[model samples]
Target chain A: MCEILRLAFAAVFVLVVIITIPTKSMGADKEYGQYLSAECNACHAPSKKSGAGIPSLNGKPVPYLVSALLQYKNKSRKNAVMQMIAGRLDSEQINALAAYFSSLGK
Target chain B: MKKISRRQFTNAAALGLGALAIPNIAVGAKPKVVVVGGGAGGATAARYVAKDSKGAVDVTLIEASKRYYTCFYSNLYLGGLRNYGSIGHNYYGLAVNNGVNVVHDWAASVDAQNKRVKLASGSSVSYDRLILSPGIDFKYDSVPGYSAEVQSKMPHAWKSGTQTQLLKRQVLNMRKGGNFVIVPPTNPYRCPPGPYERVSMVAHLLKANNPKAKIIILDPKPKFSKQGLFMDGWERHYPGMIDWVDPGAHGGIKNVDGNKMEIKTDLDTFKADAASVIPAQKAGAIALAAGVNDGDWCPVNPNSMASKADSNIYVLGDASVAKSMPKSGFSANSQAKVAANAVRGELTGSKVFPARYSNTCWSLIATDDGIKVGASYKAGEKKIDVVSKFISKKGESAETRKTTYEESIDWYNGMTADMFS
Candidate 1:
């Protein structure tokens, strides 16, 4: 009986792990996106004019944002500063940032 | 990681409030955050805390000035590259748009015990968390024969505003072919590259207006930031127009007299038509009054920029000892975001993400000639460590340099917007 109860407790713990992991990541995505966008916001102003040296990211398609950052990271994009900034971002950061930026001005 | 339940937050906060013993007022009333100084750090922190909290936090910013002139780009004004009014900014966006209570008054002192800030207006504003980002204060006596009294005659122009205008007028209207001497400050000051950049801009102005005028640098240090890059640009653009005498070369600065406009050094006593005598520096007075300083600067936690002396207070910008990061406007703005996030989380129980910081300083040598150095930082247990870095090469193409110069203008617009908007 003791052995059986221990096995049941192990099963319940595994279930909790499965339930919690995605939720935690999902909840943190928006907040993390907001926090990390500050890095971009330092140079890419939300109030950027049309002729601004740096291009605006507001209202850009999420896929385009992700693609542009990835290109910069992959050395396909031209600007050295942008490349340096984009190089550090991981896939998770790129996706989340794209989502957050795309959500802006909506 | 386990999700933070309400009871879990309570227990964790109880253990965390070692110094303040602040109760769990997160439930009853919105948390209050008071930020002092309105330059790069303070304004950014105030706006972030207020905007991010979404009306959950009461944020008040205390600044003495009606208009803020950025020290970052003041050199451009001296160079005739930008208008004086172009560099100045106001707080309308932070107050009207972001819901920040902007109080135009001097922050006389900080009451850490009560978490209150005493203003020069005889009013005390209290806070759950107080951010002090009062930049730097000049140690006037650090330079022999230089004091606040003589500052009018030989203006430092280190802190932007009327002093900048005074220095500009002095430079522009000086006698033809006159000597323009600049005494760069010692180490660990704001913008490690500032004095050299100023020299470059001043040289740019003199090259156009008074081509025969001589510019001398009596540097306290044996070396300076971007020495190679600056020297190269100076030679290419203003050849034979600028000379830099290091401490070893000049022996040392013996005395300076504003009335006679002379700098007496061990090597020689040189008469100057105009001069900028930048003095030694310390954390601003309010930080000292707040008892947050260890010696000359407040030591802050690497992860949060919270004062090591007081958990409830965070020190930002040049006033704090941010190891490995130069004291710069960009550095201050970076630190402010981290502090804002941490403060908001402490009050609202919001998820506190890890802190990341980056800074880039751009300097223009002559028309279309620019150079940059930058690094990104991450918080470690003991200190903030550089993760990645880059600098402009010595022999970059003209196209690259022009692009860099233009990029700097855009960055200025973006940085100001980030702070104010």
Candidate 2:
């Protein structure tokens, strides 16, 4: 009986590990996506002009987006707006994000 | 290979382990968190979320610029004491050293109902939580006839980079005894003491070159940061070279004609060889599109800096209305840490931790003379309270000023490291 109990506990531990791993990944995807979007949402919207000052970012190309960011990162484009944003990204994440956004239709 | 029966395998595994299962089950689901603006506040939030949540929380940092230039100590560059390169830095440390996804792009708008952030490139990023720190935007209309086009003629030097450089050049080129006019904005602007610091540094330049040159400060407010000390320093150092005009004295400009280098104020009309007008400001344009900003600034909860207007969004720095915190670089840096930790707690379903913040602003009265103010703060029942505050004591000697200048360098390095490295 003791041996049987030990075996059950080990099996349960392994199961928990498997369950928690995916749980964390899913959480990251959702949460990271949420916070990252808030920054972007400030400028790109589908609705009409939110105000007199801001421009609409409803439809733009992925290549255009990628190029714009790259330029800011490279210092070819001199803008406080572009410089502030592009300075914070990595290559892989920028690519993945670029892919993610490019997939969306205007 | 022979496959063992599921029951047999389970029994074997349990016998080998022998300890309690301790499932440590996940309650519901992990939260999705996205952060915009990779400055002091945004970057700090990303670090906190990544650290506290273990691997449970996801953090994405979207910033528009590839590099960040700190406004603190930028005066040193203007004073010709340091190069601009000394103040510029990248976010590589935040990306490689820390496990963070830093995206370079302008966040166009947030769809609150759908929980989606649309990018300028027609791409949509969905998140359960969003953080925005879009910083400040200049209100062009605040000063009549002052627009982007007129910037070449009369540099604001308010923001960093080219405009700042342009203003510096114009000052350097001015003939001996040329007039330098600095227009200070009304209440609620970024870097309250910045204009005065600029004046002080400019006075140093004139003293070194054209001793006959003079500086005129047109202030909208009656009082300024370290007014007593600044005035005292002026009397001792650049006596009669510095002058001030309050709004009531007809110094406030009603309109600006940039082309002709003329300004018409309520009380007087004047023209100068060089001028700087720091105008009224509001949250960056992006904040308005996200429906986060009211009229002037974004309203956010003091604890987490989450937008009060929207549950999914957070705002920080000069853009957000963190009522207790001043709009200074150091304040922005400290607030970022609080916001980051709060974001981590929310994502992992854990308790949000209380935040204690600190800030110090150092200003140069001359090339060597420096003055500073600092404070520590914590959350009260509903607001933030200053627990401790200090200023440089009476009679700062040359050695102390030199130390302060060196300390300024160290502070800038540490601050950049905290944000990126």
Candidate 3:
């Protein structure tokens, strides 16, 4: 009887840990991604074949993108829109975004 | 699956981590969080969740593109003070500094009922909770002749990135003494002062590059942000280079013939060498798909930044109904922090507090000369309220001008660091 009780408790413990662990891990990435992408699409199109005055992001070189962002952040670029954005980022984030775009099929 | 109460976990963590009073709290296993956007609101929110949750949240930011171009400084590019590259940003730090899994994939759809999001790669990600901050979308249907096709020719460079740069290029390439007509949108659009400020910046450029060029603004609203200040600057800086027509003054857009570059109004029909028709806008498509946005913008609880439609979701940035705060990048970053804190609290069962938000927008009238407006906010019952506001004094002293300029740079760095770093 003692052995059975111990086994039961152990099984419950394992099951609870297994289920709650994933929930705790998922965090807000999905929500944040959904929100942010929608916001960005307001302006940027993944392609160069955008309608009207919108520029195409489909095939721009990664290095060029990175350089442009750094200039904006350093205040060498001086546009209000660019300043606000470049001013917001650190070096690490700039690289990540650059990597993502470079990987896209331009 | 060892279930422990909040106090028990705290005690355990405290004892285990030693003198740090590391609460003995056994944090539930970390959940995988995937954020789609890396702009103002998304970046800030991702940082908040990952930081507050410690290792309990595995955040993966999935932005289709790597770099972000803010709409805030595009006007500088228009004014020839900045370049297109200056406004871009990256998201690598979110992964390295915050342990966020930053993915570069297109999120095709969100399956809310299943708690899963679909990506372009045909993969699906399941989450305990989701946040959607997709921002704004142009409603092409509102205007008859302003579909995507017409926009290609008459470029409504209202949105950021390429459209903006293209518009700048077109303006730069226009013949000297040519007409550049800017059709400002009606009320409840993305940046109220944006069109006027843009005209100011463009007029400044035209004055220097193409002195004989003209800019006519057709505004739907009678009143706008710092109207007096803008008019004063236009008169003093770029006299006769810019003209403004408010709908009340018969300046509203009636119809457009894209081929002819003609715009008809109540009183007159005007044709231009170039025209920019900034259309009406609403929340992004995904927000609509998720049923987060009722109409154009998603409505959220001001204090928590949580959605009214679903408790499991939060909305921020231009996509949200954060009226007390204007729909600008600064406002988005501020609101993102609030939303991030609230999400962290929800996940950890920690105490969630009311939030305070602030926004400042600086517009350049000339290369060195600029104007600004700022407001502080507190959460009200249903909305955020502007508690305090300020603007750069009209006649800026040398000291004030220098300080404002320096502060703008600091603000850019500080705010971006707060969001992405």
Top candidate, metric lDDT: 1
Clash tally for model 2: 46
**lDDT by residue for model 2 (B183-261), tens:** 8877798877788888888888778877898888878788988888788888888999998988879756788888777
lDDT of 1 by residue, B5-67 (tens): 633654465345422323546246667899999999999999999999899889999999989
In Å, residue B267's CA in model 2 sits off its true spot by 3.5
Worst 10 residues of 2 chain B by lDDT: B16-25
Which numbered prediction scores highest in TM-score against the true structure?
1
What is candidate 3's DockQ? 0.03
The regions of model 2 sitting more than 4 angstroms off are A1-106, B1-31, B51-55
Task: For each candidate, give its TM-score against the true structure.
Answer: 0.91, 0.73, 0.74
| Top-down lDDT ranking | 1, 3, 2
Question: How big is the positional error of residue B152 in model 1, measured in Å on the Cα after superposition?
Answer: 1.0
- Residue ranges of candidate 3 with Cα displaced over 4 Å: A1-106, B1-28
- Backbone Cα, N, C clashes tallied per candidate: 0, 46, 69
Order the numbered candidates by DockQ, best leading. 1, 3, 2
Model 1: per-residue Cα lDDT over A1-106, one tens digit each: 9999999999999999998787456443666679889888888888577454787678788889989999999999877778778888887788778888888893
Error of 2 at A97 (Å): 38
